[model samples]
Target: MPDDSAPRPSEEAVEEAILTVASLPGAAKTVTPEDVARSVAAGPDWQSLLPSVRRGALRLAQAGRLVLYRKGKPVDPSDLRGVYRLGLPPEG
Candidate 1:
């Protein structure tokens, strides 16, 4: 069973998310906590996540695994807001 109380994400998970997102096209950019949350929530053994998970998730996105775009420039998760989506692999 997975521990639900743990808030911090292991570097491996961050790297995995980054690699998964990186497989898509475009320059790397910011990803939202909600996005990460949703991803984490999908695991069968996973329960709820803490707010701190956002930090690791953002790190993964900003680290170049995912392409982030905003205001005509690449931005960090902290600079993102409103509705956003990942643009890679041409999701239709």
Candidate 2:
């Protein structure tokens, strides 16, 4: 059984993960909790994120940082879904 006593992953981590995934073509389509977990596994200070951060990440994505998409449809920031797209090539 899972340890209920253990602290749950922070929303910030999840949101950051979401953004990271959003940056990627496959993950941007469907953001899920599991995908976020995979992001944590990759490498992040997951222990320090807060729920607000998660919410903030979503807000950022919606605003135009991460970029959201669905059903092969591109997310236009001005839409009701507040969906966006990571259009530009990632900078090194």
Candidate 3:
């Protein structure tokens, strides 16, 4: 089981991991939920944090620092479901 009193990963940490991974050269600068989750997980429990990664992705996307993609097209973060990828928005 999990410890309810245990401190969870910070929202900032999650967002940072998303940005960091997506900013990498490969994968077209995009990342999956599991990517960020594993980066933020304390050990090997990354699977449990998938939802948190998604939520952080939404927050960062809303803040305009990140972009959420579905089916290779940029998407509105608020209406995400199924599978999605995250990346830094194109610089202009």
Highest TM-score: which candidate?
Answer: 3
lDDT of 2 by residue, 1-92 (tens): 33445566665656666666655765444554344554564344433343343454457657666544544455554452433233322456
Q: Give candidate 2's whole-model lDDT.
A: 0.49
Model 1: lDDT of residue 91: 45
- Give the Cα lDDT of each candidate: 0.50, 0.49, 0.83
Model 1: weakest 10-residue lDDT segment is 45-54
TM-score of 3: 0.83
lDDT of 3: 0.83
Cα-based TM-score, every candidate? 0.37, 0.44, 0.83
Candidate 3 RMSD to the correct structure:
2.2
Among these predictions, the greatest lDDT belongs to: 3
Q: List the residue pairs that clash in candidate 1.
A: 28-67, 28-68, 29-66, 29-67, 29-68
lDDT winner, 1 or 2 = 1
